[model samples]
Every structure is written in C-alpha cells, then in structure tokens.
Target: MGQVERAALETITPYKVEVVQGNFVSKDQIDQLRAGMSRQQVREILGTPLLTDVFHAQRWDYVFTIERQPLAPQRRRMTVFFDDDRFTRLEGDAMPSEQEFVAGLSKPRRNPRQVPLQASEEQLLAAQRDPTEAPPSTRTAPDPAPTRYPPLEP
Candidate 1:
C-alpha cells in the first residue's frame, strides 16, 4: 500500500459490533446479597453465574461486557464467594444504580418540543379579527361574542 493509503486507514476507526453479553449486573441485585445467605438466595437476586469453576465451586462469577466502536469497551465482574453453603464475601467493580446505568446508555434528545400556550375565546376572536395583534392576557377580558346564551342544562 502507498503511504497515503496507510495514513488514511490510521485516521479511520473501524466499525465494532455492540456486544452486550453475560449477566446484567445492577446495584439493586448486588444489594440483595447478604452475608450468610444461602447460595440459592444469591442466585435468585443475581441470576445464574456466568462462570462456575469445577475446581472452585464455592465461588461464582457474574461477568458483564459491552463493546462499542470508538468508545472504550466496558466490563463489569462480580465475584460471590461462599463458605460451604452460606454466602461469604463479595468483590468486584462498584455497581451502578439502575437510573445511572440507564441514563448513561441513553442519549439526550437533540431537539425538544415546546408546549403551546392555551388561548382564550376572546383572544382567539381578537386574533381572527386583527390577524396581527398580540393575544389578550386577561382571563376576565370582556366577551366579544355578539350574544351570550344561558346554559339550557342549568
């Protein structure tokens, strides 16, 4: 390849597939874990372990990975160690709150819509009449209707 082609390749970032795999670890799930809790209880809160070693059955690993282009890949690992049948110590990256995690993944709205102001009947009539005047601001403005009718229901 020519020198220019090599330089162009270096400047361009290759596409990477968004990879979301393994267990989705959240703060609420991790909080449910307590010392001396049974392995089944921990499993209920955090779901099935991604890695269960035959050599070390007492420890369970929950791995979460996200791979996206340009941005750095994210990996979260939670290890739950059990002594016999009871849960023991917990270790790994600090889990993010559900709101925080969701917000981080979501992009903010680029263009937001503005709510239109409600116009009174008089204001509407005035607008129709002049087609250029500023809208009336008083709720108690005099009614411009040619005739007012009493409610038949009343």
Candidate 2:
C-alpha cells in the first residue's frame, strides 16, 4: 500500500480516536413538540407511547425513558385534549383520572419508624428497651458530617 493509504487505514482503525457528536436536546425544542399527529407521522418519529387513556380516550402520553445510560432520554410527555373528535389543546401536565390515581396508590410503602424528641436521656434509654416506644434523641442530630468532600490531590 502507498504511504497515504496506510495512514488513512491507520486513522480508520478500531482503536483510532473518533469524534462523537453529543446527543443533546434543548428544553425549548422539547417544549415545541406537540402530542397529536397522524399515526404514520408518530410512528415514523417517536414510535409509540408508554400509556394511553382508556375511558376518557382523548389523549396519548408518550414517556421516553432511558435507564443506566450515559445520556438520559429527553423526558417528553404530551397530552392532547380533544373536543368533538378534533384536537383542542396540546399540553404536558394534565389531571390524572381517578382510576389512574387509585391504581398508583395500590403499591404499599412501609411507614418510617418515628422516634420521639425533647425528652430526657433517661426516657430515651427506657424507650430504646421497648420496640413500640420512641427515642428522645430525635430532637437534634448528634454528629452531622461535613457537607463537602475531603481535600483533593494536587
């Protein structure tokens, strides 16, 4: 191979450093997007929505979620409110239906243990002995750690 061809091949190799364009979308661009579009157009661009309204059946909400990735997916939610089979308003935040809210609440969450405060040291020790009783040291944090990290190397 010629010198120029060899150099080109070397530059295009697997281990060669390549410039990658950043995947970034501004908030303005995201805000400009609307929910309602032809099925063909939607499919061509965004594919499908995470969820759709059943009873009301006026809106389709698309949730772009990216997990454990370098760049987070542009969180875009579009709500299309319609009137008499025509698009009326294109918005983001809309009040969830009662069924949706109820379904969300079905998940159980363990309540945190509440420790009592403003009590004497003797009361704290006595309370610690019983599981039901609350401790007295809850009034204030005893030893708070520093907010910043330790000194860095030069």
Candidate 3:
C-alpha cells in the first residue's frame, strides 16, 4: 500500500519550470552606484527598477526571484532612494559577485561524456578514398539543357 501511494504521488506530481524575473544586479554593478548619481545613471548601472510606486516617487525597487525545483526559491530586493531626482542610497540583500552569481546559476551535467577529437583510421581512409563522390541516394542528376527555345520577342 505504501509503494502504491508513492507511485500515485509521483504520477500526479507536476513539473515546475524555473521562474526567474526582475533585475539581476551583480556586486560589480552595485559597486558602481554613486550617491549623487542621477536616476538615468542608476538605471544604466542596475537596469530599470522592477517596481516604482506613485506614493514613493523618490524610491525605486529592484526585485529578483528565482523558482527552481529541488531547491528553495531565492529572492533578492534592492531599494534605491533619491532626493530631487538625484541618487541618495540603497538597501537590499547581500548580492553575489558576478562570478559567484554565474556559478550559482549554472547546473552540473548529469553524465558528462568526452567526445573524441581525432577521426578514426577507418573514417580517415574512407574520406581520403573518394572525397568528391557523394552517396548514390544523395546524388541528383542535372537537368539537360533544352535543344530549342521560344523567341523572346514573341
């Protein structure tokens, strides 16, 4: 009964696709941010904010979330504050370095197989024997030229 219940649960389980959304600001990008920089400069550095509320005209929110199976969902948020259209400060979760961030996003191969870089002796000999000749099934005969043609002017 336990085995049957386990099989039933596995059959009914739905596959969940990875969901990654919002701006992904790296440590390098965040480091480039300056206190006196303008909104445009901040945008260029971190990309457009994910959320900008009308009530908080001077604040811009950058939110990032990753939902992947077999692992817990990850979320990061950064809020940039401004005064009179000039950048002031930012607050958020500790961001990963560019390299660290890339490493985290990459998944290891289940079974890595090495491919032979050099051709086998048999393959080399076959290629050298008839390099220009293609297989009979792939070869198509050219159409014969017409013996006569209608007058172009008529």
Candidate 4:
C-alpha cells in the first residue's frame, strides 16, 4: 500500500466513512420523483426525513441541515415541500421559492413605539433635561409628552 493510503487507513475515525461516499440527492432526482408514488417508494428513494409535520396530511417535507460554526452566521438548510405526495416547492439558500420569496421581502418590521415605563418625579425631571447639559453618552432626547397619572379622588 502507498504512504497516503496507509496514513488514511491509520487515521480513519469511526465518525468518518471510508470507501464509497454517501449519495447526495440533487434537484434533478427530486424533479424526477413522480406524484402518486406510494409512501414506500418515497421512503426507499429519499430515506427518512429530518422532520415531518403532522399538522398537514397532504404535505410532506424533506429537510437537510448543514451546520457551519464561524464568527458570522452560516445557515444551510434545504426544505422541499410536497403537495399531493409530489414535489411542489423547494426552499433554501441555494434554491428559493419564487412566489414566496417576493412575499417575504415585501414587508419589513416596524420599530415598536417606546412607552414611558412607570417612573417617580425625580426620574421624570431627569429625563426632561436638555441633552447638551448631560454627558455626551448620557444625552437622550426628552419624550414628546410625559405620561399623566390621574390623581386619586377624595
């Protein structure tokens, strides 16, 4: 045996698979999958799923997850949505649904309105002070209107 082959065999760990690599299901394979195929056929071809939604009986999902640990976020998720036991939609960083993709980007979340939490008179006075008077970091604009707490009736 060659030096490289000998080293590979020696360093081979239980977690690592040697010889024939695992097959990766491609878009072509998923496209070729036909509708009305029995559950047995689907299972035989694709193997078991990472997740299965029990809420929807008609839809079946196949998910592939890849975790990349880095300083920045690395998201690699593949979800294939099947309708009537046939592939209808696929979502992932690689392939995104045209219909749902546009809808997702259309709306952006609005900033929540800041409400004055319950505060004593001293706290309220401090907040109303001029921003320039306070330290550079401590400078904060005063609320447009102070919260009015109703006085107790005799």
Score each candidate by Cα lDDT.
Answer: 0.82, 0.49, 0.87, 0.53
In terms of TM-score, the best-performing candidate is 3
Tell how far residue 26 is off in model 4, in angstroms.
2.1
lDDT assessment of candidate 2:
0.49
Greater TM-score among 2 and 4 belongs to 4
Model 3 lDDT vs. the true structure?
A: 0.87
Worst 10 residues of 3 by lDDT: 104-113
Estimate, for each residue in 1-154, the C-alpha lDDT of model 3 and write its tens digit. 6998977775564878989999798889999988899999999999999999999999999999987765667899999999999999999899998798767776555346699889999888787766688864788898999999999996
lDDT of 1: 0.82
Clashing pairs in 3: none
* Best first by TM-score, ranked: 3, 1, 4, 2
Give the poorly placed runs of model 2, Cα more than 4 Å off.
1-47, 70-74, 93-154
Cα lDDT tens digits, model 1, 70-120, are 456778998999999899998999989889776667534533659989999
lDDT of 4 at 153: 92
lDDT of 4: 0.53
TM-score of each: 0.58, 0.29, 0.61, 0.32
